[model samples]
Every structure is written in C-alpha cells, then in structure tokens.
Target: MPDLQLLCLSNPLLDIQAVGNEELLQKYGLKANAAILAEEQHMGLYDDLIQNYHAEVIAGGGSNIARGAQYMLPPNSVFFIGCISNDKYGRLLKKSCEKAGVRTEFRIDENVPTGRCGVVITGHNRSLCTSLAAANEYKVEHLKDPDVWKLVQDTKIYYVEGYHLTVCVPAVLALAEEAVTTDKVFIFNFSAPFIPQVYGSPLAIVLEYADYIIGNETEAMAWAESQSQSTKSIAEIARLLIRLPKKNKKRYRIVIITQGEAPTISAVAKSGGEIEITEHPVRKVPSDLIKDTNGAGDAWAGGFCAGLVQGKTLYECIDMGHWLAQLGIQELGAAYPYPRRTFQPSKD
Candidate 1:
C-alpha cells in the first residue's frame, strides 16, 4: 500500500438509511434532522428499518470522511482504524473502504455484532440514531501493536472524531501526544454537540493538543457553554478555541466553525497574541435539489483535510470542504456522485 498521509480514528458504523413516515419518527421520539445516540427504546429500530423500510447500508462515521479524502487524494493516502465485529456488516464496511481506495486496520471482536446507525429519513430531513455496539469495544492495546504504531508514525496528519472519546480517550490522547511530539498536524472534530456537553473532561484535555479544531455551530456553542463561554458569539468561540493552552508551541491553532446554509467562521492565532477571524459564505444549493444531510460534515472534513495534505491555502481548503459537502447533500446519503466532479481552485 502507498505511504499513509492522513490517519483517522473514529467509530466505523454501518449506516442503515431509509425513508419513513411521521409514525416511525414518533415511535422513536426522534426529531426530524436531529442526530442522537441510541437508547434502550431504540433497540429494535435497526431491525425494524430493514424489515419495514427500504434500508441501504453504507460505511459511515470516520469511513465517510476517509472515503471523501480518498476521493480527492491518491490511492492509499488515507488510512482509517476502528473496531468492528467479525460479521458480514464488518466485511461489508471493509469492502466499502477498499472500493473507495481508503485503507483500514480494523480490530475484530468475536463477541459483539457490528455497530450500526439507523438513518430515518423524512423527506429531506434525516434523524440519526446510532448504536455503537462492537465499535465501542476498541482497546488502546490495538494501537500499541508494533505494526499499528508504525502506521501512526508514518502518518503526517491525524483526524479524530469526538465520538471516539466515548469509545477510547487514551488512544486518541496517544495519537495527539505523538502529533505534538513530532510537530505534526492534529485535527479534532466535535462530531456531535453532546460530546463536549457530556464528556467535557476528556474533551478539555484533548483540545489542548489539537492544532486544528472543527465543529458545527451547535457543537461549537455546546463547547463554549461547557468552557464557561456561553455568552460568546460563534466568531468569539473560534477565537477562544485557538487560544487554548498548547503543548507544542511550534504550530499555532486554527478553529473552524460551520453554520448550516450560512457562513463558516475561521479563527487563526498569530504571534504576539493576535487572532485573525474570517467568515466564508456557504455555496448555495437550491432547496429543491437537496437530498440528505447525514454526512455533510464528514464530507467537509474530508475535503478540508485533503486540501491541507496537498498544501492548499486555508481559503482553498475551506472551498474544497464546501464543495464536497455540497456534493454529498445532492445524493441520497453521505456520498459523492460517481465519475467525480473536478475541483479547480479559483485564482481570485
């Protein structure tokens, strides 16, 4: 395989997405377009979707972002590590990543079944209810393996999802420490708003080492509130995020906050305690053409990371991120169109 440039650690879930009616949403107490962790009442939701709805399984979570980066980067440039069950769904997830040219090092568990997310679609709105299952079985021992650690050493950039904090914080910290030690790039995403709200302690520790912190407006606000900055605006939150303590002083921090259908706020820390902030407007897509919003954020990270790996400027990276997110929403799931749309950077 080609040398790994980007390494991603997150829960690899098999997304079972299908359209449903109001009764289905009401049955699970799920709000339209909202994402939540699965509860006891959601136990049979996956089976019900398969048996009742026309469910389509897709590689989700970090796999979605890995595939997005692989779509833009050369083959084998992006590598993903996650825990999976020794089952058909796990095999399917592996096949999906391989098909997209993203390499994987999955830890297989014989006991639990593969993790899955049921994406209940109500027209353009999608409600995500995720059951971690075997994905939560990830152990730091897997990262300690000689071969795996070598992969980590070989990688130059690390992208970790906040959802993984629920699964393994030590493993994420280990990677973060390695990045800091090597002066490499480390990007952290607040995958969901609940992450910081519920796991504030671990989130605080990890944020100190993150060079690039990414999140949506909700997640950003949640983090701000958790950090006792609830009164701050989005741009203010970005500034605060970059000014957090850092172990590696060689690289300054950059905070990026995405607002759905609005402008994205980015803050960069400069020498002499200066913070530069800018807002990039979203590329508008007609409401009639929109499909699902499930993997839009993942697509954005994929595009942004791929651009970063290619030495693109921050503006170009954000543009590429928006491009991929736009492409993903036009599809039924968090996926891009086949035959790939070429992205040419603007001169102006």
Candidate 2:
C-alpha cells in the first residue's frame, strides 16, 4: 500500500447541536437547513439552547470532519491546519478529533474564543448559526511556521476547503502552486455557494492546480455562474470543470457534482485524451432516517480522498464517497457520534 498523508487547511470549529422546532427557528430568524455565519453575540443564544435544550457538543468545522472520516480514511493520515482559542472548547475539539484518529495541527489563538457553531435540528429541518471568531484568525503567517512548513513539504496530497478562500485566498493559492511544482495531488472542494459566487478569480487560479474537485448542486451552480457559463444544465457544468486546464501535465483531472438523494455526476480526463462524463446514483436514505445533513458533503470529500490514497478505481472512490455521506446524514454533528464503526470496502 502506498504511504498516504493528506494535509487539510480548514476553519476549526466546536459544534453544539440540539433538536428544536420551527418555532425556535422563526424566533431566531434562522432559515431551516441553511448555514450562515453568526456574530459573537450569537454565541450567547447558542449557549442558552445548549444549557436549556440538552444540546451535545461535538467537534465541528470542514477540516475537523474531513479529518473525522477516520472511519473511511487511514488512521493518523490526515493533518489539519486551523486556529482555535486556547480554551476548554479548543481542548474538546482537539480531543474529539484525536479520539477519531485524526492528527491535528492547530494554531492556538489566545486572544479570541474558540470557533463554535449552534446546530438546531427539527423534523427533516436543520439550521446552523456559526461564530467564526478564532477560526477566521488563521492567516498566511500560520502556514509559515516552521512546523507547519515541514508538514507542507512532507505532504503528498493537499485537501482544501473552499471556506479557506474567504479567510486566506493568497495562502490557498500559494498552496495550490506548491502542489503543482512538487507534483503533489491537489483536491479542492466548492464548499458553499458564497465562495464561488463571491470570490471567482482567486478560486479559478487555485483550480488550475487541482487534480480532483468536489462540489454539490448549489456549489456547482454557483461555480458555473462564476465562470460566466449557464447553470441550467448540471452536465455541462461537470464537463466544464473536468476540461479545466491543468498546471501539471502528469496529473489526471476529475470532477464530481453531488445532489442530495439523487445521482452523482462525474467527469474524468485520462492522459491520452480519453474523457468520460457519466452519472453515478447514490444509495438513498429513507426520508424518516435522516438525522441531520450538516456534514454530509465534507464526509463525501474525505471518503473519496481516502479511496484515492489507497489506489482505488474511480468508481470505487465515488462509492466510498456516497457511502460515507449516507452515514453522515444519519448522525448529529460533524464528527459522527461514535468512532467504533468504520468503513469496509465493498466486496462488489
């Protein structure tokens, strides 16, 4: 087996999740099933919910869950880069991820509170109100720390979360360029609609170095618009991404666009001018069984990357993505409720 190490740069968060009804959503001006950044003032509201409503505190953030896919990914193979306050929540976040076998590379910010989110879930409805706080404090300087730089130099694959674009686009671009010069695989995700919709130019430059890309329907649509293309057809969007000019001639280009409860669209470009774009159906979650969807896409990205680390075929890789996503929607927070159960490659 190939020795695998993935370095992820993401916003680290500690999540407090609870079950609440539409009444609470209306009271707080929260849109059901949507995630929006919140101000520090909102932390008190989340605290109230947790204190009075029995919310569970779990490790949260794109980087946290990407590493949390310890069930699918190799143990201790993921190194996460992010910032958190040197406080109790920070310790909780680190311990939670470590318990799942993910090695954390955190930049402790003493001046700010740890990043956190309040996830409110109702019947088939969920909403997130996040306080970026210390998470947003991570800057290019942190990446330059000798210890962090060493990991950057030693990594084989770079797994990036698009949210980092808003936090530090220059840092992300620099990492992409490094991946190109060093011949390391660069995997990028269109994390949310806001990223591609708002920061097009920088993201485009970063994608030039990406060997693999992952996006959901909304993100894909947003990215299509960012490229000045029509978003009416998802197939066209997939092809556009797959055909994106690559900086590394030896790297294979791959793109996947996922739709909740529907077939996944993918495009792959082989070295000899062979290109195939097709749809792969996902295993459906019965409507009654979905607990929360907060981390499904992140889980998919992690699982798919895990397959790549182990040299699995394209089809098998996507299957792992879907399977992990399905598992995610059945749980509450970013990291699943338990770490004992893990992914088993399909015999098929």
TM-score for each candidate, following the candidate numbering:
0.93, 0.91
Per-residue lDDT of candidate 1, residues 1-348 (tens digit): 677899999999888889998999999889988878898999788888888997887788789999998889989999999999988778877888898889999999999878888999887688899888899999899998999999999998999999999999999999999999999999999999999999999999999999999999999999988877856599988888888898789999999999988898999999999999999887777888887676789999999999988989999999889989988888988788889788866443
| Highest-TM-score candidate | 1
> What's model 2's lDDT at 333?
66
lDDT of 2 by residue, 1-348 (tens): 223377888889888888888777877788888878885446575767777779888778866545645566667877788889999889988887777777788888899988888888886777889888889888788888888888788877888888998788877877888888899888898888988888887788888888988899899998888878876688888778888888988888888888877788988887677778888888778878787676888878878887877678888888888878877788776555464566655544
Instruction: Itemize residue pairs with steric clashes in candidate 2.
Output: 33-126
The CA lDDT of each predicted structure is 0.89, 0.80
Q: What TM-score would you give candidate 1 relative to the actual structure?
A: 0.93
Off by over 4 Å in 2: 1-4, 21-34, 337-339, 342-348
Candidate 1: stretches off by over 4 Å: 22-36, 39-44, 346-348
* CA-only RMSD, every prediction: 2.0, 2.5
